[model samples]
Target: MSVQLRHYFRLLSSTTMKSCRSNKLLANNFIIDFNGFYRNMSTVAEVVRPTDPNLPVEIMDVEEYRRMNGIECFGNSVADPIKTFDTYRWHPNLYRRIKEIGYQTTTPIQAQSLPIVFDKRDIVGIASSGSGKTLSFVLPALMRCMTSKQDLWPRCLILTPSRELTHQIEKVIKSFRFVRSICLYGGVSYEVQEMLLNKANPHIVISTPSRLETIFQKGITKLDNVDYVVVDEADLMLKSGQQSSFAHIMNNLPKKRQTLMFSATWPPSVQKLAEQYLDNYIRVNVSQTQSLSSLTVNKNIEQIVKVVKESEKEDKLLEVMNELVPSVTGFIKTIIFVRSKRTANRLVKFLKKESFPARAFHSSKHQEERDYIIREFRKGVIPILVATDVASRGLDFINVKFVINYDFPSQMEDYIHRIGRTGRYKETGKALTFFTAKNIYHKSNLIELLKETKQTIDKNLIDLTEESEDNIIKDDNNNNNDKDSGYESSGEGNDLDNDEDESSSSEWTSDDESTNKTKKL
Candidate 1:
């Protein structure tokens, strides 16, 4: 036997003999002898300790065990934590790829979730956005593939909410280069995706639910061999009109497969979906409270809300842009979110006419146009983008300076997702909201959110309206006083023509509008 191997065997023998004789050697201290052996050997040697005959033996490094024990954990802290990539027996290629990507220390979510995933258990992980949740699952999935034999079909399937998110997961998977993977999403030709699937025969498939369902229905992709399934942005999938598609995909997958669900928030809809789909799953919540809003909402984002008339929103937006112009140096990357595609297109035209290079992204645009807009926006070619809720989810845009709500979102959850586009990766950002009477229904929710995030709430929004049952009399009197006057004006005109002549010049068809609407819940 080689010297290193001989040394390792001798060390193991000595440790085992010492433990048996003393009857006081703890599993924790038994690592000391192996630490020296590990440093001397170039290749990883599996050290198995069969403490129990009924349970499977785990092979881990002594240093890794110590680091994992040092990690802090929350919610169902029964599971062991993994603080670093080196703490577990990861595939060599996967380990090298992780280090290459400059990931040294594990984030709180990664530290806590990796151990549960490695144990081959169904897990529901609740962590904030930009908390490295992607790598938490990616590393475990790759390791599962690496420790097994290669298969002709994908052994892992990762489902995301949007095409952009599918592409993002695909990019992360590709970086490992150990397993072949393909990205499947809608808005692209099915023929191309089919051809790639047949040719690559990837071991991992990252896709959106709708596209994955289409492929599954056609019998082009099989899930019999898929032992690992990851559902990213689980709350969005369950609540955002994609629940049926998600259910269809889950039903087709193998019943014995390991499923992992990651989400920023966990509402009743998500909880119901989890109970239906997962079997005895372990819940790992890194956030202090069960509500994900308290965790995912970035405290660094500077939020400002202006109560403006509906017609003057464009003017107010322009004024805000002008104020930011002096402080911004080269390119001011901003995302302006509107309620409808019509407003997005109109805002784009108005901004362009005022010398701001802008683009519009919504479901109405062709797939290629949307792709181009996203690429150019990322490269700073188009600094301003007016979009609908399509861009509100988990797609990470780099260095977004500001997120402006041209039209306030009807749902409180949507408002969180919209601002989440900026202030990502721990970078400071700003969010400006243009609130009008149309959004008065969300005033209480907005006030609560602002207070939760420690943001300055406007006093005008604090006043209770007729919607509040307790203030019905006061609200009725206020409404009567307003009706008595010709119109209680906020010093802004209701007509779009009052702002500028450009309003008449721009004309759009109904096809250019987004039909997807979100309501307050």
Candidate 2:
């Protein structure tokens, strides 16, 4: 062994460990201890790189691999790309679990990112939501524990913005029978976290930055074993009110370890943040550059914008749900996003009074209540959920058939994320936004987003943007499309075939509209 490698192994023999700042991480805690790493990292004068025994021998050139996968990356170096989950040699149970999960093919992000991640290189992954970015880092982290020394109890740390996202990552990690994890966030119980730390002895620690800091400050947990760190939704972290916690955590980690940052949009704040802590990272961005607005809104989402007065929003929401909810049992999953906690509460009461079973979700709810509501919503126990922007981030659902913006979000980024709640995983869904006169200030941005997605702009929205809505046009043409093609295959019947809407609008077409309709959701 080289002098450097020999010296690193010496430190690994020590019994008691300090918190997290590492002088030599490769010898102490990096996930991979492959022979190629020793040769490539130690011998700078070597001419021809030896084949990686741990990876497949048939490595393609970098440019050709990028072209095949539709991946755009800028970096000093990259690893061999992956075509399927079987590309890497995984433990039999891990491979079996992936198959059981029914992932027949890798998404674009997954195919491009898994190889770089498995090579233990730093990465900044930018792709739309539902592009399978979670598993890109998650599978690699779990693989570390599956292959590591038996005493290295925790080998990875995952940080995200919200409590829901914390649990989501934990769920993915626990899919492996050998991988145990603890989830932590602010609103949850501290006693439960302490118990898990003392008892679970997990292989991964998934948390919000602030909560992880608290656990470490109390001296209950040590980061000495963490060689891999994943920052999921890195752009949202900048605004998650835990940037200081993130900085403190970064300052204390091993200097030579690997880091992965994933986000829906590649904002400058995130890029600058990545440069400070990440060393020689590769950036994997999808579709196009970050200058585009519709990065996260999938093409499968059929978007509808209806201009209604502020007072008419409640009625309009009920009407939309009535048209979309297919069965009499009312089991379709839908989410309505409001601007404030108060609005969310009021809307839930209104929805319940109007005979639509609903739940309210926001920051003010007790952590137990939030967890219960999310579970119920995800399992289809609750058919409709009225929530604030909190639900817009990383909360995954079974099948969100429709989304309604009872109030327009504060910025276009939030709008992109909110609409992304549906039409996930290449499945078709719908998003309907209630645009009132109060939201006239958002005219240009909304119109630009619609035009970029090739969606038809509402006539009322155009009038409002062209001048002002002093005399707002009452004619909204997008309503006709929804009237004809709604969940017909959902076991009840077609929404338009009902007697209620048959005599209502002169705008509604007769038998010709149903025959000529392009969509049959």
Candidate 3:
């Protein structure tokens, strides 16, 4: 064997070898032809095909647009998502600033905003919470300021629903250092805000509607000179009982100005408001279909909406918690949102009975007790928190990885607002909402919202919409495709294959299973 191998090696070495520069075979000097090989390509990472077989008609006509094939847009002449962060080449600092802050890549909302905002086109953006929408309008507002900084008043006015949102926008603007901004809202001194507005002469004003209306009424600030206006979280402001105040502020602004509105969901009220202010403007949406308006979903949140009968909730919750928090000795921050104060109290007691560190929060609780609970929750002293709608908005949780909506909110808006609590600042978090037949009113809207987020639509949810309450939808699928359906539960297997279908779901999959097929991220 050694002698034969040596003879073959000698013959191979003596033979002359030739090969093409781009991945041509040279074995035995065969002169084999290889054309257009992988090595001949220019970019290894470039995607040459869209995700779907056919591009949507609106985007198919766009000759230059190529990226974000899944994102749907409405209105004529829809702008594409930002392909590059250097949208304004003249302002070199924007590029460096975004890179420094790790916004080198744009989210879906930011992508569509690039052309509309950078080109000074009026737009209505359906941007969800924690979607980096603040930066989208802030950067453009900054650019608008560069053209007219000589003014003694604001050139841009930003109106949001809550004080928290107002300050959130202020923080983004301050980080850019391109323009000065003043946040006027309740719980802060009006005298101090007026002093800043008069003395500092901010180029951009961020405020809750009521405060700004008061400031305008007081004759301390004027928006007549403002050429750029943004209403952040328009739907929230509409729902939060500030419609008249918002109208007053909008009426006060200059008539002929670039208007931009961003909202989580597109309610009729929001659409009407946009129609009244934003003329000839493009409405940008982030979804899979060409539906008129849909909710903007933070794709980072691993949202699991479980459709279960009201009777099975207790057993399901216990099983999910056991999987998520195996060792009850230490606490992991988890919030359980209930519909009423009584439910919150009962749920917290039940969770404690099950050996989980749980606390209750609602309007019924005293301010001091609520404050103490919030402090303990923040400190990680309590792992499970049961609260009413009162804790849904404005309560900031830094690391609450899991959120359980034990009961559906009265409306879809509240549901969106409640889930927004867990997935804060584009951070990854897990949220599970228990949907019973009582929430049949939300069937259509919930289905639409789930589609917007690209989440798996459980067959049970669809069935709930079609059938009466007597016909309870259960996961009894046992076909070969059950594994492929992406449905997991802690109740009887909606698809019933693993030990018990209810216990087989990968929904509450632990951190160790992140690399697996389940949607942990």
Name the candidate that leads on TM-score. Answer: 1
Which runs of model 2 end up more than 4 angstroms from their true locations? 1-70, 188-191, 289-294, 326-331, 466-521
Q: Candidate 1: where are CA atoms >4 Å away? A: 1-77, 150-152, 288-295, 325-328, 464-521
Candidate 2 is scored at a TM of: 0.75
Please write out the lDDT profile of model 1 over residues 253-350, one tens digit for every residue.
88888888887766677778788887778876653322233334666688888876656777888998877843446558999887665667667777
**Which has the better lDDT: candidate 1, or candidate 3?**
1
lDDT of 3 by residue, 1-521 (tens): 44533443453345332333543433331222222111112111111112122431111212234334345556665543444453334355655676677765566677677667765688887755666667778888877786564765688898877655665578778887877888887654678877888888989988878878888899988777888899887776776677888889888777888999876678888888888888888877654233424455566678888887667888889988888854555766888877655566566667777888787765444333555677778888877788766566545678788888877765676677678777776688888988876567677777877776778888888887424344345544442223222222222223221110011131322112123332221
What is candidate 1's CA lDDT for residue 161?
A: 78
Q: Which candidate should be chosen as best, given lDDT against the real structure?
A: 2
- Alpha carbon lDDT at 43, candidate 2: 21
lDDT of 2 at 456: 87
Q: Estimate, for each residue in 222-317, the C-alpha lDDT of model 2 and write its tens digit.
A: 888789999998777767567888898888877768899987777677888999989889988765433363254466788899987655767788
Per-residue lDDT value at 100 in model 3? 77
lDDT of 3 at 306: 85
Quantify all predictions' global Cα lDDT against the true fold.
0.67, 0.69, 0.64
If both were scored by lDDT, which would come out higher, candidate 2 or candidate 3?
Answer: 2
- The TM-score, computed over Cα atoms with residue i paired to residue i, of candidate 3 is 0.66
Clashing pairs in 2: none
